[model samples]
Target: MNSGLNFLQTNVNKDFTTLKKNLKKDFTGLKKIKVALLGDSATQFLNQALRACAYEQGFEFEIYEADYNQVSRQLLDLSSDLYQFAPEFVIVFESTQKLQHKFNSLQKSERLQLSELKTEEVKNYYHTLNRQLKAKLIYFNFSEPMDGQFGNYSNKTSFSFLYQVRKLNLELMNLSQECKNLFILDYQALSAHLGRQMAFDAKMFYGASMNLSIDGLPLVAKNCCDIISAINGKFKKCLILDLDNTMWGGIIGDDGIENIEVGDLGNGKAFSDLQQWARQLKQRGIILAVCSKNDEQTAKEPFLKHPEMVLRLDDIAVFVANWNNKADNIRYIQSILNIGFDAMVFLDDNPFERNLVRTNLPEVEVPELPEDPSMYLEYLSALNLFETASYSEEDELRNKHYQQEAGRVIAQKNFTNEDDFLKSLGMTSKVEPVNKFNLPRVAQLSQRSNQFNLRTVRYTEEDVLQISQSENYFTLTFDLKDKFGDNGLICVVVLKKEVSALFIETWLMSCRVLKRGMENFTLNTIVEVAKKNNFKKIQGEYLATSKNGMVKEHYARLGFSEAGQLWELNIENYQTKKSFIQLN
Candidate 1:
């Protein structure tokens, strides 16, 4: 009887153990940040954070980190390789340590290997090669290729030699550019600044049995924080500044502009630091506006003549150097920019001003300013944010870009015809698919782009990779380069192939490039892709969203017929359809 009882107890415990494990697994599935990783160990690092974060949140992550790290020759080819994982974004991290090493290593190699790369364009060559190698290694998350597809597509291709690596990366960059869903994570900048040996004491995954140390990855938690902050920033715009204590020291009207402590020496150091930092913001794509009650010239002189002043007149997107209520100034700034209330950031030195704005413009983001003025530097720097996947040279010229916009408006005043005004602005639009070179920006767009999204499916860098590799999944990204300079990657088109049919899953564009004919160009590219794949019919589903009503008839205009509520277009019929614009 004792032995029988013992046996029953043992079996019951075994069943309980099974139940616990299964419950944990189910809970993990629910909480895991599902990422389909692409590229090098950098991707692995991001996964580690995600895993940790999931555990802490009482969830588990479903991730696929590619065994190889080289990018695909094209995003179109992604459907053939990594698409099975079904990731949220295609995570691509840059390795700063390897860029110089690879370039130097290549330089010492054979002359034949260096044939394709321009010696003078060493930086460009190295970057291109890095993408190729990383993509090859990262494109395949698992050890093997899908059932029957190419296992080592990067290697099987001709001229994949190390010396000829630049050639491979160039092609991969092109491929990624074509895929709209490819999200490239550039941890390189952080690693480059912080050095490769750097690790963080940042928050890690809690309650996780699978202890993957963050030290295994380079930028770790801090970079992850940056990634999060960046995603949160894109949908935001405008900055409202406080006058008396925030911009400078003491009351501006009482102390006088010269008496205001805003210099490199003495107590003015903090104010100078703030000015310089704020000045740099305009260069890095953030808008700055001020609110103060003082004589306009007095409030403006520090920026004009103070030797220690870091900011310039041009940097101020808008400012109210008057006694008027600050909340009113912020409202005016928002109206002038045509931006929404939620996109604004309010900064005040006084509790009164901050609270007033909070009550009135509740949508505006108001991060609590530190009480001690000495901590302002660290406080503001923490909030600068790592938004968008990448920043190009044009990003530095944000003020100039907007200035040109103002010029366009002013030039319009002198011209009677809209066409003539547009023609005078000398606008030029260059539309291209998302590539490895622009993958970071594309991913940034995926995260931040809200208004023009057909379906706002925000993806991280890793999710983009799985989509890129998804069998028959095609992602198309578009760039707008007009007289306003490059708006960078501004539009995206995600295509999913279900057996013989092509499903237009998600199509979105940035509001910045709206009404500029980018949509037509993107539609044209989709038309061409569907024709090439011989998809039975181009189909799209509209779920009747609040913001996507503008696109309600998108497929219909592209020659699609409505089947009940679903839109379907024949490839043959779409081939002949023409819009008012021409695409290359």
Candidate 2:
């Protein structure tokens, strides 16, 4: 029985029957989440598949499945079962078959307005549900259907079903961007990936109004679970690559840089394509690292000299190329990253190396490389390992941030006194309330920060925005900069006012800025806020999770006295803590 974190490390069975068997397994101790599933078509199979797939991902979903064709009623009525259940995620799966039926009933003039009307309907559903509940909306986009009425000419007309479906998909994307709580599930892409014949069963639809075939239910369920897991902050953040034969064809030492199969060389296109894909991932904020079992100079030769290489040295945050075991090298990389093993993915061509890493670091995701180099990218892409819930401008600069941290590490070795080293850095921090400018990064940190987080409460951008506008809540964001480089938005604190006391709702900081006395600076700021507002006391709590054990004694170490299950500090008794970081 693999834990949720280890399931993706190997190519575990995803067969529908196999997933169904997971329902019988012990679900004790799994993280419980509430989900409400509403579909126009029959959703019994989808509901079952979702529960089973969620079990494999280490979640026990308490699902509230609405009766068939109850999407509108469940969403519009505030006192409905959906509202009563108060689910964390509300999935709206509207079948394309049902959409086509609605389109066919419209007059020819109304047919031209089908996409617009349907988009508005979905927008209404989202807004109504959002106003009533804080649950995130996961709506499925329609898969394209070729009605053959206009044949190839449908591209020229807006009234055609094919044209309308494509327009509806685009409209849904636009709507999702406008509405922060709304998320569009790419059902169209999934159907295209599995092909029409396999995705939809005509006989099953005719008999039982099942839009998805039995074979495809597990995949659809898995996709839904992936989005949910990502929203909960369990997504991959790093990609570790092997150099010889994995990044390029042939051994770098034996084949030489010029003879390496990259660019227009032998079987070079596949390797080049993989590198291009990796570069795109890096640009999107996924940290890239190298863990190769070779001489450092030899492993770096191709990246430095090979013109066909898509990846450059600057693209990698940590590069470990030595004659040591790959597992130890990966562990070293993890240390520099300061992230959990579950957040990293290691790609290698050698089965022995992959197995060794899997056996030792079971939490690290290790995908099985196909025998043929041509199939590598295709297989990895299908896994969808890098699903993310949010993106910000700060993400693009993550590589540079890590590279600067490396410089700090080397500089620390030269100084003996910790105080002198800290003062030498000349660190400055800018503290401000949450606003439109930094809301995305604040919400992203809330989801991504785990180890240093006192209470692991994940929040979406919508949730953060609402809290920012509430008078009952006080928010603070910290931006750190030193002589080396800027570590953008390193810490966030949220406090809720209750009579004469301020309760700390959230206190999470990036692991990158840990041990720099940032925690003291943050606490000093929190105390300042409490005193300025005339609050008599401040209260905080530490909620333990599998990954946040590092901060279990955080309150105790910060001079907070234990009060029942909570930590408390009287504002009058609190003294300002000293920190090297100056407020800017």
Candidate 3:
């Protein structure tokens, strides 16, 4: 077993045994989220695993576990314990065998009808819960059986049990398109990757009707918590890699660039495959950084000159190759990136270097790599370190955008005065209401943004569409560009109209545009909108979270007076300040 997978398994067992150790501890002072886990079979072990995973990520989770095999009963009964708990998130885990059992008693034609009826029942459960309270629903899809009676031809036979389950999974995918709060947990993907035989234990299923084997329960639970954490805006944004033995086979300093092993031959194929994976991630908005203990010029040779290398100098957002301590190098990289330490994952081949960074900077996720290079990619995939909930067109250009920002930082050093530097950038912004064209990127920002978010509320594209159509709500997205490059969709602000006051429901901006006078520009726009709408004052609130402490005094700094926890700026007294940003 590789170190990453071995750690996951060990944590699963240790967490299950020590579940209550941090039940009441709130180290980060984040809100205690309430969650209910509803399942059709024995799910106590899964619940335990979720609690442990939540605590590991510094979230205080109040998980309400429903009775065994009582998913339908609790969802149907309005007065049941599930409704009384009033969870903010609901997870419904249903097993394939349970549905198969029902299909066995039905006729051949009734199988399709059975699938439709079950889907409708699940829809009704969501509708019933939404009518009573606001809860995001995570519905688990069916994990296909290992084998069917028809063998390999089961997919061609519509009447086969496997065919019915496959159709049901497709229906669930379609349902997610219509339901704004419904998210499908792809158990089929996880099971297919882990192999169905290992995923299900026949002895445990017959004895206690468990949905998964004891070994597989941990993976299911971990993935469930991973989805929840992503909803709460906890995910990795950067992948820092090492050069010598990690990215390729040999050292570029000792063996010349021509002698390095990176092509598709023998041991070199593994390194080439690893580079391909990293390049794909870079294209999809993951910031790539290089931290190696070697000469900087020597390290740059391969990316600059090698024909077989998949990654070039342009693909990296920050490249730091020096003889400094690995921990200190990561800190320097973090400073330039301006992201939280917890949002980084460092990959190095040497166990000594990994342990040194892990001990000094515990927040940086240094994955334990195996000795052999062949197992590197598989180990990283098994850890699932890069799971994301949303994507948009802007993701593809994120690396180039950040690289341009780095250039601006260097350009600012030549100018002595800060105002001169801001003026030199020739910054321009286009502020407009959210529309069909930019809805996906707007929603993506709401889901992933954490540090600069004032209220820390997440919304889907459907939710933003409703706000755009509503008369009482105002949705605005800001796109910024300077002389260097375009920072796509940099800011988002959602305002709700009260009788006399305009409430700032959501306000978040990209950290890349911080210290560039974007906040003053955004606030000036808000005041102009307020005056035109005949409002008395504008109100904003900052909900304190561990990640959003950087913006705790955001309103105060913008000249808004504090009224309890709410900040108010009277329209009559509002002063529209001149900004360097030219608005369009």
Candidate 4:
């Protein structure tokens, strides 16, 4: 019972019946999130499936289901129940069948304009909802209808329903890029994966007006829950790879670099494709680490010498290749990375290794790779392990930053005094108010940073933008750099001005910058801002979360006096803290 197989059996194989049974499970302590589901077809079953699946994902969904087929009405009307619900997420589901009916009603000339017209309508709905509500919008792209009207010619003709649906899906993706809060769920991908037979029930559509089949409901719910979980800051951040049979065909130590299968060799295409996939993940900020039980030099041979190897040594943030127990090696990697075990995905072909890691560190996600080498990519693709809520320029440079952190670690050993080391690094930071350029990363930090986050208030780009523009709120973003490299936008602070005191609404920093006097620099900066703004006192609070215990005494260490639940600092009495970092 490996974790991969167990995950598939428990979650992917769960049908409507099994999901319904989950509704009875106690959801007392699970995190509660409000969701408003709006659909153009019957969505009672979808609503139930979402709630049940969310429970399994450790979320108790408080869903507000709009009246059947009232997507436009609920969004257009300001005083509607949708607005009253004040959901954190709004899921807009427009069935393909309903979309087809609208297309069929138009003239032949207008048929070609179907996608354009529908895209505008969707944009209107999104803009209307966004203006009224601060909720993140999750819009379902239409699954192409299997109408044999034009047969294979539908792709060739722009007027066909198939063409319109696909074009609409592409337009939705483009729109999502423009709209920061908009998230387009690939319903078309999910439907195609499930196949037309399972995804749609003609009988159910006629009998109950439900477009999604009972068999397909759980998967749809799972995908939706995956998005919700990601937006709420629970998603994979790192991918751990096992060499030999895992990354390539045959063992590196046994087969040798030239003999190992990769690229055009025997069963090489599979391993090559997997490496390419891992490379893409790395490019998108998922830190890549290696944990293998092999002789250090032997494991390094393929990556260094093999022409077919897609991953280079430079691509890997952390490389641990020794005969150490993989569980212990992974623990060491986690220590350096400073990320949660649950936020990492371990991919290894050997069942024994996967099981060992799973048994020792149950929080780490070890997918059960298929026995066959060829099916590796397909199986992993279906799992959708890396679901992200946001991406920015900062994300692209994540691996390089980690590599620089490694450099800083090596540099630290030369100095006995911490202050001397900090000063030697020549640390400088660019402090600026959050604007259009850094809004995405600021919002992303608000969502992704759990360990260092005070108050644990998650914000979307929309929220960050609103705060940035408000007179009552002041925002600060820190970009740190040293002799090693630049740690892009490492810290975010949001301050709210009260009558006399300035309150810290949000204060989060990248853990990589810990013990570098960045905190002292940040506080000194904060005090300067308070004096400039004529604030009498600065107030901060440490809201305890399961992961944020490290910051429990953050205010106390900074010389803030505890005043009941809040920590207060008098600006006039505050002395500047010593910091090696200078403003850039």
Candidate 5:
């Protein structure tokens, strides 16, 4: 292990203590979100850590915590307080000790039956909650026991108590595929990362029935915050890497491309692994950019000529290699990408450079890099910085698609007239209702799109599926293609039909398709849907958010008259809007 990460994981106990002391009031400008925590063991410390973590990430949390050992009662009863709380999120963290106690008390012949019954009860509870409330569920899996009586044979024995716990965890994972709103919190993974000895304190477990040690609370809380942030569309989308000693073993400017240590030998393997990891992220829609303190030509040599380089020029969306300050360079990269500073992660080997960027751009995440190159991959994997809430097929080709977008920008300079430029691109759109094939992408747009999202409401895949299947609701998904490339599944709009009006429930689009008349095309489609359904009025709304200020005047720009907080256009009086996009 590197000294830097070792120091960080070991010395953060004091910081967490200070954090718990200062968790009295919520921060300003954060959205108020309600949550309920139901667990089998004492969970006051976990709740405290959750609040502190949530507040740090700009969330004003109103938590409803049920008493210990109330999981079964709160879940089974329809009129329970858990349902009455009407939480937006429900977190369940049942203790492994309780599961083991039940298994140990059962006779040998009844062990397998007990596991089956417990799994069925859990599934029923989830189904009941899904039917009764709109809240998203976060259920934790069981942790392994410290010691099993059968020792090495415990996993091999099918009817053993330890074996049943493993079976239950696997069953939960498989069940999540069927339950769209159910997300499994991998507590066992966290326990393994921190080591079982450090995660479980026997004295605390015996005295107070605490599942995790006091020092382990902060890490667990951090993982919980990562999940919450990703669900709310606040996770990082870009990674800015520094070359030379950072991506390799030596300074590229001094050692030249041939001498830089990045191959399959010795310390080189670490940098090679790091590059492979970055390449995988690129394939999954995370933008990669290079910001190094070397000449542009010099930095290009390694990616161009190195035999073992996993990342090439085509993989990088933006490359800014100059002697200028890194903070300034990162701002330039953000401009080209059109993303917020909070969505970028800066990785540099120099402590001074990392501190410089952190001071200048406080929103950017600057992780403390380990001094030893060999520890880079392991340390980063433990952090889980790129956790995602959803995925789609389009994500795999995101890097190539963005490269084509850059080409379009250059092509635009060749034409003086804006309309001629747009026409030259041969832009076409396919407007269709959301179906089983496009359900995942539609839900992802709702979860990850913030700046282009009006009203900023989030929905799970299950919620979107229900909306699509409803008779009175209309779900629209837009796909865009131009001369440059295909931008797949770029926009999503949900409309709910009332007695005489069709109300817009969601209006979100990808930033990449902005200023291309997609919004105008979408409005025309909305009116068409309303006319076909025999609705009298088409109603919309624009909720102002710090990130969505660009769209505050969206309805007004589309000629909809404002009626207090709502915008409305009478279907008979509405005029069709013209657009260059050919709709299918």
Candidate 6:
């Protein structure tokens, strides 16, 4: 660790000092990415590293620093120099304490106003301090020392401190909805990757040795590299944790489910600790699955019977606990989940098992866990590797949902008619023009949707808002409710007026809501919008893609005439056809 630190400090000084020495003298014409760094000493290092990175990338980075613990200073610093910098990206560090510092200052003001702040407006408030957001991408870094330097203090990574950090997570999640490219880069997530391999003790550096010792500092250069990499490539989707001593201490296959330690006492406590932490990950909506070689029934017994099993079997989306190779199991889980190799994080105590998955599923991320059992908590806690800037409570039940949907598919064989099966779902669809609230989900669906999408026109939250506020265009989303559950915002539609015709700009639905006549109802709504807009005709296109063959003839199904190469639905011709879904 000491050697690693010495090597790291030397690397940082070399990287940063070299960048500063080669600083571009001309700041005028080159595309300037104005960046503001907020917080204390640790944050300064982050800016320096980022500036050097920017320099190496051959870009001019104009940087502004705000006083530590000075929320007023944050406000003041932005108002004066933000516009001057004209930052293409705003990287806010020491941000975990933003709300706390604001509250403390409000206590000082005595008349601090909370109502005056709007979730979206609070972001623009920064613009009032600096310049308008030229580059709308905002990356937030929430990292503090385990020694209780920045965030709340605790001896054993206390619940209170983790709770505050979680709060910061939620705030950024909500905040991200208000802006395009709002990213929360978990500093702790990136640092934990280095573990004991690096050092973060405040006093870890000294002189040329210090120059070589930057890795000892928390949030080292490698940590920066990982975060940038994660942001460049989106976070993984599934966390495939190994059972045996990994999920809980001791192997259930060897020790029997009842005897396997995982409760409030002895080795049980360690398993319980891991189970408890895993539940939080589920809550954030990241899919949790099991990939271990064990007797399937015996392994499941503990989760079902153990009162201390915080990770109930239902909480897990999939389990491939068999005698088969772990890599094969991961492939099986990924098949049903329909996610990318880059989206899965494999957690296993055995280096052999971890390495097997790495070699076979090279895209699957396998983060290192320290060898010592006592190091489990910090090793896992420090490696905050997953990122979900967009999350919801519904994410918690995602696994159970896949199971229920599977059951529904099995039950579908019982129905003689398709409408009977669809009606049995008790499906209800509520469609309205996209407003500020639905803009987030609508934009998210557009960004992620592929298969069921008629036209994959992705838009930002701001872009969605702009379309809605336009007189010539309209955008809207649908809320789907069924006997199973509320599907949340599951569909989107965008329409615009071009020439004297109604043009369907984009139409997409969550694949989860597909087989139900939601498509027909959605098209009916489009025609009504066209009728209301007094268009002579309506037009739409089918951008041929490998996956969208399911809806290739969608315009023809709506009784549109195949005119030339384009699909056209003149209002008079549309009225002649009786293509409409009977909304029950």
Best by lDDT: 2
Candidate 4 lDDT at 396 equals 76
Error of 6 at 91 (Å): 3.5
Q: State TM-scores per candidate.
A: 0.56, 0.97, 0.94, 0.96, 0.96, 0.65
Error of 4 at 101 (Å): 0.9
Q: List model 3 lDDT by residue over 485-510, tens digit each.
A: 99989899999999879999999998
Is candidate 4 or 6 superior in lDDT?
Answer: 4
lDDT of 5 by residue, 159-264 (tens): 8777888888888888887888888888998887767776778899899988888767877887777887888888988999999877888888898887888886
Cα distance off (Å), candidate 5, residue 462:
0.6
Q: How many backbone clashes does candidate 3 have?
A: 0
The lDDT, on a scale of 0 to 1, for candidate 4 is 0.90
Report lDDT per candidate.
Answer: 0.55, 0.91, 0.85, 0.90, 0.85, 0.62
Where in model 2 is the C-alpha error above 4 Å?
1-13
In model 2, how large is the Cα lDDT of residue 197? 76
lDDT, model 5: 0.85
| Candidate 5 pairs with clashing backbones | none
Which candidate comes out best when scored by TM-score?
2
Candidate 6, residue 389: how far the Cα is off, in Å: 2.1
For candidate 3, the TM-score is: 0.94
The TM-score of candidate 1 is 0.56
